[model samples]
Target: MQRKGPDRRALETPRAAGLAGVVFALLLAATIVLMRLGIPEGVEAVGAGGFTDSARRDAVRAALALIPFAGIFFLWFLGAVRAHVGDVEDRFLATVLLGSGLVFTATMFGAAAAATAVLAVAHPAGSAPSLTAWDFGRHLAYTLMTDYAMRMAAVFVSSMSVIGKRMGVLPRWLTAVGAVTALLLLFVSSNVPWAELVFPAWSLLLSAHILLVSGRRRRVTLT
Candidate 1:
C-alpha cells in the first residue's frame, strides 16, 4: 500500500499572507524599539561628568525589555516569508536565507542581554577609580565592539529585502532600501543615538506598504 503525501495546496491562503504581514510589522516594531533603547546596556542620561552609573542601569533595563522580542521577531520573520512567498521560489534556499537573518538577530539579542546584565550588576556607583569600575568599563567596550556593532553589520549585509524581491514578495525599491540600510549599518551603528532611528524608519515604510498592498489586492478580488 502507498501512503499519501501531505497536501501542499491546503497551505496557501490570503489569511496566511495577512498573518505573515502582521508578523513582519511586529518584527519591524520590535527591532526599532531594540535599536533606540535596547543595545546600549548602560549610560541612560548624560551625567554631569558624563555617563553616570544610574544611566548605565537604565540602558540595561531597556536592553532586557528587547531580548524576548528580538528572538520572537526572528522566528516570526521566517514564518512570514515562508507563508507569503514560499510557493514562488526555491523553498529551501529561501529558508536558509531567512535563517541567516534570524541567526544574526538572535546573536545580537543574546549578546545584548548578556552584556546588559553584566553591566547592570557590575556598574560602579559614584566616582570610583577602583579596579572593578575599570573592569566593568572594559567589559562594556568589548561588548559594544563585538556584539552590537558586529550584529548591525551582519543585518545590513544580509539584505533580506533583496531576497524578498527575488521571491516576488516585495518591490525592488524596498529591497534597495534594505540593501542601503544594511550598508549604512556598518558605518553608523556606533552613533547609538542616530543608529536607533533606522529600524523604526524602515519598519514604518514596509508596514505601510504591506497593509496598503494587501488591502488593494483584496478589493480587486471583490470587484
Candidate 2:
C-alpha cells in the first residue's frame, strides 16, 4: 500500500491565514497609534478658532485609509483560525469566537466612521463644529473603540484561547498570555489609556506561533 500525502491546500491555508493575521495586527496597531496621536483624547471641543491643523487631519485620513484593509485581513485571520480548528471545534466556543470576532470588527468600523465624521465636520474652511457635535463624535469614537470593540476582542481572545487549549493546538504559555490579555481588555482597557494595544500584541504573537507551527508541519510533511 502507498502512503498518502498531506493535502497541499490544507497545508497552505493556515500559513496564509497566519500571515494575514500578522498584517492585520500591524495595520490595526498603526491605525490606533495614529488615531491617538492625531486626535488626542482630551480635546473636549474645538475652540472658537476651529480645528484646522492640516497635519492632524492628514494623520486621521491615513488612519481611516488603513481601517478597511485591517478589517479585511482580520476577517481572513478569523477564517483561517476557524479552518484550522476544523470539524472538531466545540460548537459553543466556535460560536463565541465567531460572534465576538464579527462584533469587534463592526464596532471598530463604527468607531472609524465616527472618527471620519469628526474629520468631515472640521474640514470646511474656518468652520468649527458645534460643541455638541464635537463632544458627541469624540465620545462615540472612544466608547466604540475602547469599550465595545475591546470587550468583544476580550471575548474573542478568551474563547479562542479556550478552544486552542482544549484542542492542544496552542502552547500553555500562549494560552496564559491570551487569558491575561482578555482580562486586561475586559477590565482595564476602557479605564487605561492605550491598553487596547494589548489585543493586537496578542494577535501578533498568536499569528507568529501559527506560522511557526505551519512551517514545522510543512517540513514534517515533506520529510
Candidate 3:
C-alpha cells in the first residue's frame, strides 16, 4: 500500500489567497472612491447645519454602502491569511486571530447600523435636516470606537507576528512592526485615535505581502 501525498489543494491555497487579496484590494479602492465623494459632503452639510433631508438620506445611503465593503474585506482578509499560513501553529493562531478580527469587524458594522437606525428614528420623515455639530461628532466617534479596534490590536500584536515568524511569508521586520503597531493600538486606544487607522493600514500592507508571495503560479514537484 502506498502512502498518500499532500493534497493538491494545499498547493493551490497560496494562489487562492493572492486572488482574494486582489479582490479585497479592489473592494477597498471602490469603497474609498465612494467615501471620498459621499462622506465629505455629508459631514460638511451636517457641520454647517444646512444639508437638506433628501441630501442627507442620499449621503447616508452612500456612506452605508461604503461601510459594508470594509467589513467584507476584513472577513475575506482573514480567510486569505488562514489560507496561506498552512501550519499547525499558524492555523491555531489564525483561528483565534480571525475569530477575534471578525467579531470586531461585525461589531463595527453593527454599531454603525444601529447608529444609523437611531438617527433615522430621531430624524423621522419629512422633518428638517438640521444636524448639529454634536451629532456629527458622535457619528464619527461611533464609527471608530468598536471591537474592530481591539481585535486589530490583538491580531497585529500577536497572531500576525506568530504567523510571520512561523510561515516565513512576511519579513521578520514587518512582523515586528505589526507587533509594535498592535501594542500601540492597545495602549493608545483613547489618547491617540490614530491607532484605529494604523491597524487597518498595517493589515493592508501585510495582505499585500501575502499576495505578492502567492501571486506566482507554482511548479509542481512530485517528491
Candidate 4:
C-alpha cells in the first residue's frame, strides 16, 4: 500500500489578502489626501491661523480617524502575503518586509498623534493653537510622515520587489514600478510635495495585479 499525500488544492481559497491590500491602498490614499489638505505645507496653501478654520481641523480629524483602520488592513495584507508565501519565502527578505511595514505603521501613527496634539491645542471652536504648539506639532507630524514613515515604506517596497522577483510572482513591469516607487519614497517624497502619493499608487496597482493573478490561478485550477 502507498501512502497518500494531503490534497493541497483543497486548501485553495480566494486571496483575502489581495482584497485587504486593495482596501488598505484606498484607505491610505484617502488618509494622506485628507492630511495634506488639512495641514497644507507651503505658506500659500495655508496661512497663519489655518488651524482655526473648522474645515481644515475637521479634515485632520477625519484623516486621523481613518488611520487606525488603514493600519489594521495593512497588517492583514502582510499576514496574508506571508501565509501565501508559506515555506518558499526567504527568511531575510521576509524579515525586512515585515519590519519595514511595522515601522511604517508605527511612524504613521506617531504622525497622526502629533496632528491630534495640534488639533487639541487649536480648540475652542475659533482660536488658533499656540504658535509653539502649532509649530512643534506640524513639524513633528510632517517629519514623521515624510522622513520616517516614507523611508520605512521605501524599505518595504524594495524588499517586496526583491521577494516578488525571486518568487517569480510579480511581473517585470511591476518590479520596475516598485523600484521607482521605492526611490521616490526614499528621496523625492521628503523634498517634493505630494510625491508620497506614489506609494499608495503602487500599492493599488500591486493589489490589483494580485487579484487578477489570483483569479487566473483559480480559473486554471478549476479547469
Best by TM-score: 2
| Candidate 4 residue-wise lDDT at 81 | 78
Model 4: pairs clashing at backbone N, Cα or C within 3 Å: none
TM-score of 4: 0.92
TM-score of 3: 0.66
Which is the winner by TM-score between candidate 1 and candidate 2? 2
Order of the predicted models by TM-score, top scorer first:
2, 4, 3, 1
| Candidate 1 per-residue lDDT over residues 120-208, each given as its tens digit | 44435544234454346445544554446445544633445755677576787887777766655655555544554455456455656
Which ranges in model 1 have alpha carbons more than 4 Å from their true place? 1-56, 91-93, 122-159, 190-193
Tens-digit lDDT track of model 2 for 75-119: 999998898896788798999999999999999999999999888
Q: Is candidate 1 or candidate 4 better by lDDT?
A: 4
The sequence of per-residue lDDT tens digits that candidate 3 reaches over residues 1-223 is 1332445565566556555555554554454343333333233535533333455456556656766776776666666567656455545776777767776666656655644553454354545334553365345534554234455546535776777787666687788888877776666644543335555556656666665654443433342
Global lDDT for candidate 1?
Answer: 0.52
Please give the lDDT score for candidate 3.
0.56
RMSD of 1: 6.0
Worst 10 residues of 2 by lDDT: 42-51
The Cα error of candidate 4 at residue 71, in Å, is 0.2
Worst 10 residues of 3 by lDDT: 34-43
Rate residue 92 of model 1 by lDDT.
64
All candidates: CA RMSD in angstroms?
6.0, 2.1, 4.9, 2.8
